[model samples]
Target: MFLLFSCSGAFSEVVMAREKATGKMVAIKCIPKKALKGKETSIENEIAVLRKIKHENIVALEDIYESSNHLYLIMQLVSGGELFDRIVEKGFYTEMDASRLIRQVLDAVNYLHSMGIVHRDLKPENLLYFSPDDESKIMISDFGLSKMEGTGDVMATACGTPGYVAPEVLAQKPYSKAVDCWSIGVIAYILLCGYPPFYDENDSKLFEQILKADYEFDAPYWDDISDSAKDFISCLMEKDPEKRFTCDQALEHPWIAGDTALCKNIHESVSRQMRKNFAKSKWRVSRRDVIFLYHILPKTNSIAAATLHCHGHPHGD
Candidate 1:
């Protein structure tokens, strides 16, 4: 077992290794058994959920090895880096390019929804490329926050990254697969404008903005963006989860389905803003707050309820 690289997360550490027998490279997720003492069910749930899903856009689980101290999950290696990094590295990005990428994500989400699995956390960081090749496919990863819901069952856990989290989840409401759709909407917004729709140094203020669905295609950034694209985003970002477009509907939207040319180069503005926004402390702050809100607050009803009262916002499935 040759160690390639390692990445640490809140719950587990992922190590890349080469199989001695086949010489195949794989990602090994090292999860400590003690960390999952009370939450062993979640690991089982994740394994069961992943084992059944075999989509081209989803990461595949190859094998599992368990010891008294840790559980090892061997997964397919995705070496193409993150979706955000790829977009920034490109010289000529365009609306059509964004469309193609979104379409692939939507396809994967649609498949998950069909299987009654809700990817509660759907953010750009979770999207990976199969390889460094230009035509590599995007693979959705990190199922730590995902939920496998049964028919008609609604998920009440308010878990997900901030900014990308659905309004309904923050409201402590019973949410469904629409939460993924809302996250996709947020991704789409960033893809078009190169900045998050709801951004603030304060967590409460940011939550308020998200709850109210307060976002716009501001001037200069959105000057060249097509109306069809804006409309597509609007339908997905609808405050009312019921009113938000389903993955099926979003794929059928004119911006995605219509004959609108999407090959224009948007790299100049998008990349510039992406660099500026990421360079600031805003993204870091939002990420920290989101983890706090999702993990800590949800454990206590009083605190969760108090946090939920900080603002009114909209979200969908």
Candidate 2:
């Protein structure tokens, strides 16, 4: 089943890699030189925010490199795949399952807030899976749109994926990390249902729906979900920025709030095991490895001569 991982679309530079020795996979998101749009600072900013963050649920920045006019980000790859694909494959999450998944994401975000990194993009594509057997091992990746708190000045760029972009961002307001939390709400809703809460062919109309803050449930599916799940999502989707839950506080909310004693203990044990795994894993590489990638990477938007050796050998990446 091992094959060279490649795909093309908007910003066709992106590619996936699966490490052979460790059976571990990772996504290598290349920032094309021309796509930089006179904004080289974002690459630096993303690196700054990601390097300081470390958590079980958040994808670890494995390495960073630049070369051939492109920047290469070596990230922990989620193998079970993107959450959006899962919804497409299975149609929807069965209430408790969706809640469990979103709750773990809240935990990851809670950790990020502690480090003051707001992941500007928190949609299903960015939420990755480790293995089909290990759903709880999901990790949040993609720090390209991330922002760090108490650093310099607030970012005013009105850039984010249309559907998941928070309304405040579209308003072009100088926004904070809270923008990320709003996106999380959108993800939670999408996971529970088969589709997003709001949909419109007109981007403006979609923005209006988001601003108006109305979610509709048509039939049998919404009626069958739990009040607790609905209430938690409502709490997250609040339009008023002041009332929204910060990541840390969201972790303790009732929907996710269980006695943390067991989860905490289990995570600690898992950490110990992860470190041991890290030591023995054949795919291990230091940040310097990514700097190597930076040197080898091509300058264009396409993945020209991107040897899969970034993962292990010539065939995988």
Find the candidate with the highest lDDT and give its number.
1
Cα lDDT tens digits, model 1, 1-317, are 43323333345665555665566666666666766676776778778888989999998888888777777788877778778778899888889888888999999999999998998889876877777778778888867667778745568977888889999999999988898999999999899888999988799999999999999889988999988889889999999999999999998988788767367799989988888886565463222101101112223222121111111111222
Q: Give a tens-digit lDDT track for model 2, residues 1-317.
A: 12233422233244565444555445666655665555667667777878898888877788877667566677765556655444444422355556578778888887887787777767665676665554446777767677778877777777666667777777777777777778888777665555577777687898889877767654654555556667777777777777877777667767677532111112222233334433343313211112112122323323333433322111000
TM-score of each: 0.85, 0.71
Cα deviation at 221, candidate 1, in Å, is 0.4
Quality of model 2 by C-alpha lDDT: 0.60
Number of backbone collisions per candidate = 7, 7
Model 2, runs deviating above 4 Å: 1-37, 68-70, 87-93, 134-136, 258-317
Clashing pairs in 2: 26-77, 64-290, 65-294, 66-294, 67-294, 68-298, 68-299
CA lDDT, candidate 1, residue 42: 70
Worst 10 residues of 2 by lDDT: 308-317
